[model samples]
Target: MSITVQDMRKGPEGYAWSRFGLPEYTDWMDESLSWKQTCYIGDWSFLWQHRFTGPDALQLISDYTVNNFETFEIGQSKHAIHTNKDGKVIHEGVLTKFGEEDYMVHGRGGYWLSFNLDRGNYNAKVSQEDWFMFQVSGPNAIKVLQALTDSEKLLEAKYMHAVPVTIAGHDVYALRQGMSGEVGFELQGPKEFSEEVYQAVLDAGKPHGIRKMGGRIAMINHLEASYPTIATDYIPAIFDADMADYMDFFLSSMPSFAQPAYIAGSFDGQEPSDYYRSPIELGWAKVVTTQRRGYLGADALAAEKARPHRVLRTLVWHADDVADIQNSLLREGEHYDFMEMPRDQRGYMWADRVEINGQLVGTTTSRGYSYFFRKMLSLATVDVDHAEIGTEVTVVWGAPGHRQKSVRAMVQSAPYKQDRSRGDLHQSTAP
Candidate 1:
């Protein structure tokens, strides 16, 4: 009854969830370079999608989310987060407005739509649907996409935008969003056409040097891109009553083999406290605008605008120090401290409580190897003082063994990788 990649698809290449799909090499730099030098196709159909329609759909959404959707144009997408009364994140997703009364929301978690429906104050209806989503990335991604679609206007589509186009004679939704920290596109289409679209990209990319990438390489890219993932890189928001029920369902439904997976945060089967975050802590303050009228969690978020507790910062671990710890265990018969990767194909790690000088200063969430930066990096929520760049601190890694070791780590900017790709996407010249 648990969720498995096989539950999503099957093949000799297996599903993108296959551990074998990851690069055979361990170094992320080489793997990422393979994509940058050529191209990489990723299977992203695991993301959940929901469709909303009806006369009251706009009103229903406008009143519940922090972002203003009143002026959203058709064929455009906007990112928004739904929070509980206490301002804890419920779900984050891209809102795609197809028309005045039709829209689709895509996100990692599935319960947000259900929670909105359960509230019963809105007149619109929500229903979940199955769709296959794929991400084509690297230098030549746009070329491959352009070959498949006949729409000449696609070349003009800007970043963070979406356009309806025909691909291989099938209608597909192509978004200019990418998680690989590269110039790319996300192609969403019907579940039945999943393999066709996947093959089309592979075929068109053959001349351009496209390789299939797995979750391991994708984790490195996410780290470099500074994109945060729920249930792996951050604590799951457990503030709302219906959201609590959804979390229970997710945990209970997980397959027996996946039981050891880490579930973030302390829900404890009760309403969450004020210790949770507003949009600011999640590094999403840009989307929070108070210029418009009232919305859900607006007042609370407005109050937090004046006084924000913790800011999101990046931690870069010294390569020599990390290597020494590992070598100590292998060469000197000493056990090295274990640091968890952000998204392990087998399972995930819980957020580690961080302390500095005997004071509870922060919590370290997303941690991964940055092949491009050639160092280990992590995303943390820390107090104002500890959040400053160049601040040094100690982080406790690994589960409690016979002996637990704390390693020295330093705070840096959130995005360890320079966002050259984002800039390149907007440039007139080809990447």
Candidate 2:
């Protein structure tokens, strides 16, 4: 028998440095709260990295990226997206330009970029780099960071800008960015300096109530911040007939665990190809400027942009229904798949089918608990007509042919967590 997507059910099952680096540095709940109450530090060294160089590097990037490239500059970063000809997102990640023709990417975008660079008529060469990433985020993040580097220069560090700094007497690249949607910085440097910078941040952050964040609570930041991630939110676009050979090689090269994808939702797409999403569907339509430098699928995306489609939104589950899941666990054998704290499903998209008035209109991704909001929430995509705030809908919270229960949820604005990261450094920040 051929392999199937359900095989992804066998995720990395263990509690150690295996997936969650610290397991629970100080407990998932407390760590989840550190970013809201004070500050939190996270290690993301294991996130893949890729570098590209050559005269055609920028051209290669421009051809594929949907974001504006005219303003992209050195030391600046972008939430880069890669999509198939159908305009559905293939992969995306954080991309930074080191020069006009030099670029570095942090995430799975490497694999797709490499594949294209090898076949396209470009002089660019791709190389995987070993970089260590350490994040310091929260209301007190600036203070802790200022204590370590040039406060005046760091003060100019705006959102999404990468700056150079020295920490623990080691030169490091400090990127003023955060997935937590808080005032924070993601510090990166050579792999050898990981320990040095990590310890220094922990020590300097002591006065700010810095807690070491782990894998369990790390992704919670995405929900509050509204940052969509690959795999967990959408399947990688590699199953199209045109990409058959590429998919075969890509699957063979990836780890056993990374091969299978866990698909959940009411869409009932025939295969991964049918599940691919577009920029408009993901609520990234704003970045799809058609009257400019052409990128991959620009014409097709422009055509689709003019049409109506489902858009991404946030859902606040009903308090009563959320409580019933737990209440059911106590009375029966197994009820409602058992909602877990921090996040419900592990390493897989907790996608559920979304509906409005008995009509299947959308799907949900990234369901989890937010210690800051004290509510269970999820990021979802629904028809543009039903994408308004305060709109009521139903979310089927279990796989088909298995135990399932429908929960009531209301459409809410995304980045559900208030935007306070842009607040002044000296102000008392509250979100």
Candidate 3:
């Protein structure tokens, strides 16, 4: 029997929790604040790693991605975006250039690259590997990393640049990339050394008050940093009929957490494409290069960039309005679906409709409670006319076929938190 994404969207609860193998060793609220006040190491081993090699490796990547790779040098990485023919983002991830013709891509974007590899007559050879990817992030991230390695590479590494370092007698590549909107490093190494390296870093970070971020609050940084995630933020563009074969392979090969396409909430689109978003709508227009031509969706992206309808913004939900929904549970009649604190434990693309005077204007995703800010924040893709700062909007929060609530929200910057990931870590923001 063949299965489709619709087959999986059978319930409002969506799929089970995404497994990262680590539960909260401390309070989730404290863990939420760790990346801001102190530091945290979150496990991202489940991220797909695909390596491409040979003369046509860069060509294969450039042909399908929207990034300008003309100056992508060794030891440097770029946040690459892959889109379908319609310019809708299929997947995005970190693409690192290792050698002259050697490159590796992390996240679902690799699958898209692999899917297109055979379609073209490129000389690239593709290989898949399991890697232990850990992200150590926060204001004190540098101090914690400095304790683990004696190499001065940590001090010399530039933003999005990978430096070779030895930790626990194992060669690990540390990439100076921050997803937490703070100083951070993504450590990558062979899976065999996962336990040793992870433990060693934990021990080294003990003095810096490092927190073990579990699956619960693991994505709070992403929400605050405006990093849109696949499946959770937007449905991949693989559901189209042309990509049926690739979709089947993706479903059969990828893990449960990585495979689900279940969606819920108030933004009722008639079809899957209604939920599709262009890079411009996701606040990634800066990464799209008009200089690069012939990529999968170059023409469509160029067109969208010229006339973008929606822009990304942060929506701050009204406390009293949200409280009323929860308060309804204590009252009578029907109650709105409970708003999960921090974030929904069940990983669903919970999109709510944004409106102004009963007129649809935008859609909100990645809604969560930021303990640090003491407010409920969500990422919204609003019509450009209504996306300005302080623009008041109403968010209809509830799953389909359930009692909904009208929650007032105000538009703010896309990244609710100030981005300091690319800032000088040597200056030390740690107290």
Candidate 4:
């Protein structure tokens, strides 16, 4: 039997975080609020890192990604996306340029890049690196970092740009990139200085009300901000027969926690390939550049962009209908799949089928409850015609072959929370 992704679902189950450093430092509800009201410090050292160095490093990156790197400057970072020949994203991550020839990638994209580097005739050499990455985000995030370093220099680090700063006398780079869709800075440095840098931020953040964010509610931020993550929103496009060799290498080299990916909920894709999504479908068309060609999936992306069938949007589930499903658990013989609070505790995508007039028109993924908004929101890729704001749809709740319920929903613009990732730091002050 072929080793499918479903076959790799080994135990260590409930929210599988044996490798994730911190599951919860405080209550998840309070931590979730920190990024919106106060501030939060999240440890992202679990993200895999890769270093590429050579004269041809830039060429290698430009040839593979959909991004145009002609203006990518040193000390700047990009949400780099790697796609297959079909324009479906394989892996995406934060790629930063430290020097003209020095590049670092933090995420699964490194594996794909390194694999290609070995196969292609390029002078660039790839090696893994050990680094510590922590993100401080919220309206009050600037105050915490300002207290630790030169406020002027800290403010100089524009969004997606990195600036060198010292914390507790330890040299580190502060990158202004908010994953929580708020004013935030990512503190990155060598592994040795991780403890001191983290402690310094904790101490500095005390007065400003910084909470140590946990893994449980971390993805709630992604849902609110419309950041589509791999395995959660769309499966990687590397499981086909042609990519079997690469998949083998990936499974052998990666940790077990990073390997397994299984599908659930009501979006019944016939095959694994049906779950693959292009950049255009995922609301990342802005990131795809076509000024020049030769990149993987360049032609496919151009065609798809011109006549996109579906677009990503946010869905506001009807409160009463959601309550009806939950109420079923109390007074029914066969009840719907129990909905987890905040978000699904399991790491599966938990995708649900979306429809209009009883016709399947889209799919919903990344469902979560935002205490800040007091509403249930989810990301959906619906037909372009029905994707307009206020379009009414039905989200089929529960997995296939189970008692399901039709929950009414409305199509809304993505990033349900107003985006403040690029808020001016000078004006942002802690209360």
- After TM-score superposition, what is the CA distance of residue 36 in candidate 3 from its true location, in Å? 0.8
Candidate 2, residue 160: Cα displacement in angstroms equals 1.1
Quote each prediction's TM-score: 0.83, 0.92, 0.96, 0.95
Model 4 C-alpha lDDT per residue in residues 1-431, reported as the tens digit of each score: 13453442332453443334457877888898999889999998988899999999888888889998879889999989989999998888999999999999999888888888988999999999889999999988999998899889887777899999999899899998978999999999889989999999999999989999887788898999999888889988887887887887788776665554666788777667778899999999989988877899999998988899999999999999989888888994998898978787667767899998889999999999988888899999899999999999999998778988999999999888899999878889635
Q: Extract clashing residue pairs from model 2.
A: none
Every candidate's lDDT? 0.65, 0.78, 0.86, 0.86
Error (Å) of candidate 4 at residue 155 is 1.0
Q: Lowest-scoring 10 consecutive residues by lDDT in candidate 1?
A: 265-274
Which stretches in model 2 have alpha-carbon errors above 4 Å? 1-22, 265-267, 426-431
Backbone N/Cα/C clashes per model: 2, 0, 0, 0
Better structure of 2 and 4 per lDDT: 4
TM-score of candidate 4 to 2 decimals:
0.95
**Model 3: pairs clashing at backbone N, Cα or C within 3 Å:** none
Name the lDDT value of residue 298 in candidate 2.
83
Q: Write the per-residue lDDT of candidate 3 for residues 136-226, one digit (tens) a residue.
A: 9998888988888954789889999999999999999999998999989999988998999999989989998899988888777889999
- Superposition-based RMSD of candidate 2 using all C-alpha atoms, in angstroms: 2.9
| Model 3 Cα RMSD, 1 decimal | 1.9
Q: Assess candidate 1 and give its lDDT.
A: 0.65
lDDT tens readout by residue for model 2, 193-291:
789889999899898899998778877888888877766677777676787766766676566645535555444555555556787877788877787
